[model samples]
Target: MSKIQPLNPERIAQMAAGEVIDSLGAALRELLENALDAQATRIQVEIWPSRWQVRVADNGQGIPASELEQVARRHTTSKLDGCSLGFRGEALHSLARLGSLTIQTRHADDAHGWLATYDRQGELAHQQPAATALGTVVTVADLFADWPLRRCSLPQTRPLLTLVQNAALAHPWVSWQVRQEGQLLLSLWPGQSLQDLLLQVLPQVDLSDLRYQRIQEGDSDWEVVLGLPDRLHRPRPDWIRVAVNGRFVQMPEWQRLIQSVFQHTLPRHRYPLVVVHLRLPPEQVDWNRHPAKSELYLQDPEIRQEQLRQHLHALLQSGSEQASRRSLHLIRASEAKSVYRVTSSPKSPDPAPSGQPSTPLPPLKALAQLYRTYILAEHPQGLWLVEQHLAHERVRYEYIQRHWQPVELQMPVMLEGLSSQAVEQLEQLGLEPEPFGPNTYLMRRLPLALWSEDPEEVQGSLRELSRCADLEAAQVAVACRGALRNGIPLTLEQMQQLLEAWQRTANPHTCPHGRPVYLALAEKDLARYFRRRWGICDRPISDPKLGSWWELEPLGDRFAAQVRRSSSASAPDPKDETRSAPL
Candidate 1:
């Protein structure tokens, strides 16, 4: 048998390219991450589509002339001591194998920088002097030039271009640019807030009702901003972004939690848009779970997912409740009868009408509140009995339930003395709070009334809410009670207005507390009750029907003929399931 010599560097490089990095974009992302980890203040990326060249220049710390060879070698990194999430061994090797890799660097202490180029032999092809700077610049040319199979498998330019745009949107705080044939296709400015970036990129998006959120779980914290009802757009499933420890991840559970909250509230096709920032202790998460670093593994993932969901639900509930309360207040204030004094305007009224004294009249009739609940009013349409408490509660509940953008609070509110049981339970309910004080906590902002106003009340409510395993139901209950108990009286005009408002609300039949508001007696049902129509007229009644006196007749005997005919007409088939079940 002939002895086999080791494969040549060209063969090794080709094999490495195919085996290591999955795609050109993923390979580029790895390099970018390294630059970011190096504390680069600004990074500039240039792409030459015609020449198949990609270059990334960063003002980060550079490799010295002496260390140039080692830096270009495979499986080498200065940033990791094996404790970091993305300290993998194959990034540099894979890039070097697939393309012509060149690196130019300047050390802070030296005036001159070193430049090195690596060829297919796994050795430095050339090393020379370079320009003066205290940073590193890497350029890759002829990507996948040696590997026809890998190059052929790569996606076309359009999807690749979209990828670049998405990356820029994900990191608005970092300045970035993507150029094709030396022409800029994507450019992002630094210091831009996420919302600003969203508005700038998604011009059609309405962000007027955006709000902020934060949730703390021991050392872990979550922050986010969500869009309001009018701001929310349909069909875009990925309107939400979740980041752990300032690094973004594409966690499926995050979407599920928020989607579950809005599933019943939003229409069948509508999706809630949100941007969430999660910060957990570095040790608690493994960010290298995927090549893109968009997927992560939390040590206690179930707890984390639940925490995120509850926090979002809380923010949503709070915001809706607050809006409902405000609207109710406005309606109450508007209902207060205003008294006008007759002065110079009275001179005009005196000529218009004859009065014993020129006195302005009060309301035509005083509206009565029956049983401290119903409002009896005479409208132009007809007499209306408005269930005051239930109507107001329904109005408040729907307004609170309306979708809105998320708002972040300047200060985090942390609740204290929470039983360990409650804390554990809260996580299951998705209420993760960040530490703010000795024992108090700051919550990720949710809609105002979705969460309890008092922290002490929240602990119990959360526990109960979780027990039923139905948070939305619990939220409705709480909101309804608060709304109905306000005891805001309504005038006749306001009562009429309440009907208009209720018509605009969702599920107007039930109060926020899950109680019925009104019962409309239809003409048919009312007539049936009086044995006038659609009634069981066969029953013997002393009252006469249609001016005819009721004759004495055996009720059962008279109904026998009708019952026999009905039974015969609707007789069940012998082969039916009910008949076939048993003898």
Candidate 2:
């Protein structure tokens, strides 16, 4: 290669754009941000044939007639108010360099609008009078054509739709609409409240069921509303929004913080619908750190604490009618103790085919207990050995999973010295203890599948539930606790019941935690290990001490013992090749 030479201005300009625009989605985001920054209240977006063409029109402040073409200049902006969504100047500069750009705008004072079009070099190609309202429309066509490599990474329709949805949710007060190939795809109106707008977005949830709350601290405020569990079948994550001063962003940390609130209420793979808006002074929020202006950092401790407080409150409300202060007082997630309220079927799954005998494994005949822990059972084909504790656990877990339902206590038990909120939170775990006397409550019901469990086992189950993150774990934990305790001798009736229940369960081989419940040893396999199954020796090694080569025969223990005693006192007969054979 020749010595490195300086690149020309044209090459340098294109190189600078490579860092600014990477995909069609990136270009679209820039266009959308610019529209919002212009104070657009009604925005319409149109896309054609995937990433082929895109146009965004906003009814907001428009550029002056004289300075329409100058907008392509680098680092140029009219947003000096500091309250604008973003001030990064690379968006338009990079976009114009990637493909053809057209801007049609008219100021309110202007009699008519002017249209300016440009090629990838940021040079104006056409300028003429164009009919338009008091707003701006920016259209980018031939996306990433100049940079063929970046164009290859173009995303499908889903990603672009997600970007548009985020923009719409960011400005709930703004009327938003979308069109694809002259066909209408989405329409949203600026309604009375955010919930109204969300209702239009997600018709699956009933708007009235969502809980709403507003909290303020100093100059900052947070508005949040969420749907009830019954109505929480949310759509794509694009529907869940977190905006900072009317600007939606990609903040994983904020999303995770919100997810923590609904940990016990929803599965890990699923999420509930929530709409939250954080309004604060522009100076208090920092958006300059990320290239997308998508990440925001909150520097105000008061606002941070308020977020934690409200998050806890919402979690409690959704979790149970009773909110426990003990769990909510801890603001930091590191210190927050995990507590779960059980939400499940109100009754057991169903009685095991009423009065039908459970399928029995007759091969396993119960024999005796070993170490007071394992049950030894005999079988002609094999030996059956089981750990009663684990077996019982598997039996109960499977039974409960099938026959799960709410449970009623045979008699009430009383306990004292717990607060009402505490009791309520506990009841969420399916323990129905109610107030009976001062600082006391009478426990009346338990989780349906585990109602007949020992009180200690029930308490243990609840304690285990506190460590679990979801409902399945809670159910498994309860089952494990209610099962037979290890080292406890079981009566004949109890063991029989356990076996019968285990047989009724769908999965009886392993406990809920995935540990094997029992082991089987085949008699033939055992005989092989004992060296007693060889009918006759095809070959034998000579033993000088006994002066004999061995042969096997179907002889009892007494004959083998006599042969061994005689071999110790006698030498092999030299002339007899059959001397080693046992009769």
Candidate 3:
């Protein structure tokens, strides 16, 4: 006897059916795709978790009565043009082999509908005449019946819900409803725009913060909708959705690319909510690579990747620039409300004198320092509360990045407790450290921003930088260390200078570590809080006499001087030394 023998047709069919209809989710996907291919504008899905059954009904161009018998036969499909989502007629056949299959369909030309049933081997069992609408309805019961383990392992609700959501995202124009045991689980009506769909799906994000853009280059066109830089984000990348040729897919490389575009603006380990749709010529797309059709291969992938990167960068940069211009105007308007006299020199370069045109800064007028941590400033539209430390950090980070050359110290600073890995990373970041004593390193050169930092603090920052895996992260660590400490009081002139430096940085909205630099309370909001209409005060009050209720007392000049000296001599409170977490 021959050692090898060809498998019988029955066994071969069974294996192929197992591959196509492996789980409840896969079976539902195939049925849903078939409905879409039939040009369905409305689809309804019903699931019975207790019995492992699924039913899908659609208002589409249904199967003709003449071809109804052959619908369950393998390789028998009317869509030979390869334009439909399901071109191979194996879906119904595989479905029949896995469980009981029934299809009732009526074409537009037919006066009546026909109902057909098929057995496990896909053999036609019964046929009857039925009155029905102009569409198709398919039901599959006892899915994976023969494979007890697979049937028991299948999820009942979440998988089905996710599948429906993915389909709905790609086809917002199609009305859909998914029910479980006759209880409605999910529903989407027709006539919804793409932005509306996104907002409905992701309720956590604000609609105004979302941005939409469309780009067409060469043989491909793309539609992108995403949150503004760091405005909305999630802990993981699960919220990023991508669709190719109207089919939602799992494209890991594409998701990573999108994340990389916003890496600088978003905090570490955070991802923005984004939706991307790419439309390419059918010839350039290969959907046959996966049985589930969840992955695709595109021609000229390198060219497409490069184009996407450039366009996304431009879009985000443009949005940032517009926001900056608006902020500048608002700041100038606010500055017009008050006037101040400069008393002390600014640590950074001074802004241009009153009338000369220079780099635009949101000329906010500093009113007072609040709690020794926040700077209260006046803006035309509202009140701005700036986190003094983070504002300075943003300024220092940008400054260090722009001027990164190292300067040799007259006397080398010795750092201890640095690991070998940390020492190597420090050197790569332009801080040349040489081994001195046991577990100690001598830093001969430092970045200009860190040249004046105290030796002990520099050592601490260098130790922190040594643990960073990348040069950019190390630089951020260094910048955070050199920034002004919290709880340190600032003079009026110093606060003004700090705000100018902050507004001049490339990204003033967030610190290098991605913390917001300031919070704005618009005047209009304040009016609402007081139950007054904008630009109109509902209640009028006469000016009160202060001396009638309270008498003014002045402190002795010697006592005031002593209090100032004590404050200047005090060290930073340990409770206020909160630092930004590492990237």
What lDDT score belongs to each candidate, Candidate 1 first?
Answer: 0.59, 0.68, 0.77
lDDT of 2 by residue, 306-393 (tens): 5655764664475435333322322222122212122343222322454232333443446678887888766466666678987887
Ranking by TM-score: 3, 2, 1
Over the stretch 344-368, how does candidate 3's per-residue lDDT look in tens digits? Answer: 3212232234422233334577889
lDDT of 1 by residue, 303-417 (tens): 8777777777776765542443323433334333222221321011111122121222111122566765776643332233457777776666555545322335444445666
Q: Give residue 47's error in model 3 in angstroms.
A: 1.0
| Best candidate, lDDT | 3
Which numbered prediction scores highest in TM-score against the true structure? 3
Error (Å) of candidate 3 at residue 302 is 0.8
Output the better candidate (2/3) by TM-score.
Answer: 3
lDDT value, residue 484 of candidate 3: 89
Off by over 4 Å in 3: 191-193, 318-583
